[model samples]
Target chain A: MMFLSFVKKEFLHIFRDPRTMLITLGMPVAQIILFGFAITTEVKNVRMAVFDPSHDISTQRIISRMQASEYFDMTQVLHTADDINSAFNKGKAELVAVFSDRFDENLLRAGKASVQLIADATDPNQAAMLTAYASNIIADYRQELLREHRIPFLIEPEIQMLYNPQMKSAYNFVPGVMGLILTLICAMMTSIAIVREKEVGTMEALLVSPLRPVWIILAKVAPYFTLSIVNIISILLLSVFVLDVPVSGSMFWLAVVALMFIIVALLLGIVISSVATTQVTAMLASGMLLMMPVLLLSGMIFPIENMPVILQWISNIIPARWFITAVRKVMIEGLGVSYVAKELAILAGMAVFLIAVSVKTFKIRLS
Target chain B: MKKAIEVENLTKRFGSFTAVNAISFDVAQGEIFGFLGANGAGKTTAMRMLCGLSRPTSGKGAVAGFDMIRQPEEIKRHIGYMSQRFSLYEDLAVWENIRLFAGIYGVPEKEIAPRTDGMLARIGFESGRNTRVKELPLGWKQKLSFAVAIFHEPKIVFLDEPTGGVDPLTRRRFWEMIYDAADRGISVFVTTHYMDEAEYCNRVSIMVDGRIDALDTPKNLKQQFGVRSMDEVFHRLARENALTSNAN
Candidate 1:
């Protein structure tokens, strides 16, 4: 019963501070829209320079085919190799395709043609993607040529992109955004709020009260937990309706995982508050310590498989990584709870461990 | 008269340093007990242990008949603590702060409204009931905090330098509130550096270097020390401690 009053006071504190209210309520929508549209890994409308000396039907066909695809925008037609270098230097094109003079003859006589593709390797990921797209276009052109000539001596590898067939980057980001934002808002806000009491000396009054130390920590976190749930619903809604991100799995399982993750975040916040004596220190600890790891190691923006072996090992310990994987499995893979059981168990274990440590630390600090 | 608080050989040590070293004292049920000490004289530490906020390293103490070590929770229920810092929610309105403490202290829902209104009127802040605590003047905040501390009417209210930086007039007024609370059968265990305020207490203990060097009525302490004022009494005791430590 006393706990309920503490929760009420916490809510009043949140609602009265417009800055905190704005960050808690407004951040998720803004972040979802920002991540969905502005921040994307999928390359689109990539500018390319084509140097086709032959100007033959085959070369024209390939260039036109490349232009036809949504991925490439043929920005310049280079007359010489010098133009290719200048086009790259001036940032006029990300990819340059050069064909030899006898390209059409070689295709007709030898059933294959050499196309040299040069890409600026400044951003290795984007460069690799652009090169892959060019190669795919050339391969498609080769298949069309063979089909038209009635030739059947080619190996065609059929590719299928499972789970996310359209390859929408938004599908990947929505779940990550859910993990990052929830962890950020829940962990950072709870820690700062608790430390604010300590900074202002009200925590002493609270400690001297009849409320148990654990109950006081719970009351401090209860409001943030509610706000996080609201954030989850809003983020999920935005992902589904606005960004067209699908929730193929059961909403019940998703909510279960989300609640577990939120608890873990809140426990982390409690641990932080126990160590931090000031609001600024709490903010710095949560923002720097939690946000950076969640963003980089959780596979939020970068794929975990692509990280170094040691980094991958480190990422395994990040709670958000498990949560993001679980969310992806549920939201995109349409998998049942059985598919995400390991992730769920790990998250639950982390929640228990963090809660235990935080409670112990808080008790020590209070005494 | 019954004892509101009892302490014997209360010693709190932080590793090698003794913060409150084996201090012993008692307060009558309605007495205003002034606890005075130098900056690092362990007054806050002893008060913290008595309030059940901190455990005594080794001692026996009780507040309102509850053991300090074994029944700290019971001690919490029957005592109020006001720290040197104005420890109230600055963002909350005056009445909301009262209601929050009332609720935490388990004041019934039915009594919260009347009690809150009464507290506001008593503090002469009925007009500012809706004003945020941060907007109130420092003196008013201190007064409101004191009023809230005693709102639950605990057997004992511990004030830890409740008038640290307030003006002399305001501090005097605050002492009046303390006297009023004490007169209502609530023992006031107050710690202060203000020697003049120490004179108002029924009895005062002057602590130097974690030990109480003197404990008596203000008039008696003055006569015993052959001093004209409590300030002189306090200065003589503190200077003697400094001189002894230097000799060591």
Candidate 2:
């Protein structure tokens, strides 16, 4: 009864403002479209500078084939191997293809040839994609040789996903996008809403009313919890329909676990609102502070195994990491609910701990 | 008259400093009790303790027949509070703000609309119930805030500087509303830094350095202090306290 009015008032706050509506509903789609399309995980249109010493038929054919495909553009033709550094430094090319002096002769006589791909590894993901594209193109040339001249010297291993067997970039990152968007929207929005009441002095008014402090905090978070669930549903729809990333696992488990993570995020917002006296403080506390760790340490973009051992250990405490991990298992790997039990346990533990901390602080604030 | 509030040795200490130091007072039902103080004289602190917004460091008090310490939540059900800062959601319409506060106070769902309309009618604010609170003038906002505070008809209502930053004419009108609430047997415990407003109360208590320096009717206080007005009475009390502190 009283709780319903509090929840209704919270909804009124969100709906009466246009910007809040956009941020709560539109942010997920915009971020997903931007990440899905603009930040491409699969490399294409990569500019390449060649350092071909013995410009033989095989070398010419391989370069032309790579250029003919949509993946690579042979941008600069270099005179010597010494030009590789300058070509990379000039930034005209993301990668330089350097072939050994006797490229075709070694292939014909010794069944061996070397083509070194040097790429800018500053963005490790793009660098890896560039090298992968280059090797795949070279292996294609090797395939043609075996079919035409009966020579076989290469083996190509394909990258595949169970749902998206062709390994679409969207398939790889949809879970990650879900992790980033839900954590930020749920935590930041909930905190700002609660802190706004404090800033406006209505919180003190509500506190002095017959309503319990626990009910007040719950009312503040309830609307955002509902909104975040809306966000999760829309994100899943966009992943499946727009981005072509299928959820191969049971939908029930996926929704259940996502709701659990939202609880953690919302509770985090409550704790933040308890410490913050102003809306701006709450925003910075939940928005920028939560973002860096969520984006970097959550294993959303960077793999946890590739990180330093200390960083890997540190990532364990970040709630988003467990969420993204569980999402990948359920959405991409087609795993069962039992597979995410450990992740579910961690998130539930976080929710309970935050609940206890918020309750303690709430009682302290009352006194 | 029955006592609406009673307190003895109500002290609130923030570490080494006591904000409200062993203050004691009471308000009879239907009385307009004024709490006057200088800046940081701890009037707000004592009011918060009575309203169940804060726990006293040590002491005892009862608000609306409930123990302030052991039954803070119970005390909340029987009292209304208006903060020093304007307490309505500025973005909400007048009726919406009324509904929200009334509903939170646990007014029956069916009674909210009629009571809202009745209060608006009595205030003679017709046809602007849909106006957002921010769009309303400061004077009207203050009136609406008072109306909402007592809308649930709590036995006692605490007003913390309810008329700061309003004009004299508008302040008079606002006090008329307060007088009407008190006439309905609602105890009004109000605090103000403005000495002139203290004259409007049935009984005024001047707080100086966390203590009630004087408690009496306006006429009695002036007669006792050999002063002409509540303003002079307040100045003499504060100035004497300043002189004592300087000597110490």
Number of clashing pairs, model 2? 0
User: Residue B44 lDDT in model 1?
Assistant: 81
What stretches of model 2 exceed 4 Å from their correct place?
Answer: A40-45, A49-57, A64-93, A96-102, A109-168, A308-313
Off by more than 4 A, model 1: A39-57, A60-93, A96-103, A106-168
DockQ of 1: 0.79
lDDT of 2 by residue, B110-160 (tens): 999888889989999978899999898989988988999999999999998
Identify the candidate with maximal lDDT.
1
Estimate, for each residue in A1-367, the C-alpha lDDT of model 1 and write its tens digit. 6888789999999999999989999989988988676744789999988998989998898899999999999999999979988998789988888887778887787665678878765444466678788889888877787789875323232322222233435477788889988887889999999999989999989999999988898898888998999999998889889988778999999999999999899889989989998999999999888889888888777777767899999998888999999999999889999999999999999988997898789678766
Cα error, residue A362 of model 1, in Å, equals: 1.8
lDDT of 2 by residue, A127-228 (tens): 668778888888888988888878766433222111112232446577877878777778888888888989988888888899998888888888888888
Interface RMSDs of all predictions? 1.2, 1.1
Q: What is the TM-score of each predicted model, taking all chains together?
A: 0.87, 0.89
Using DockQ as the measure, the top candidate is 1
lDDT of each: 0.86, 0.85
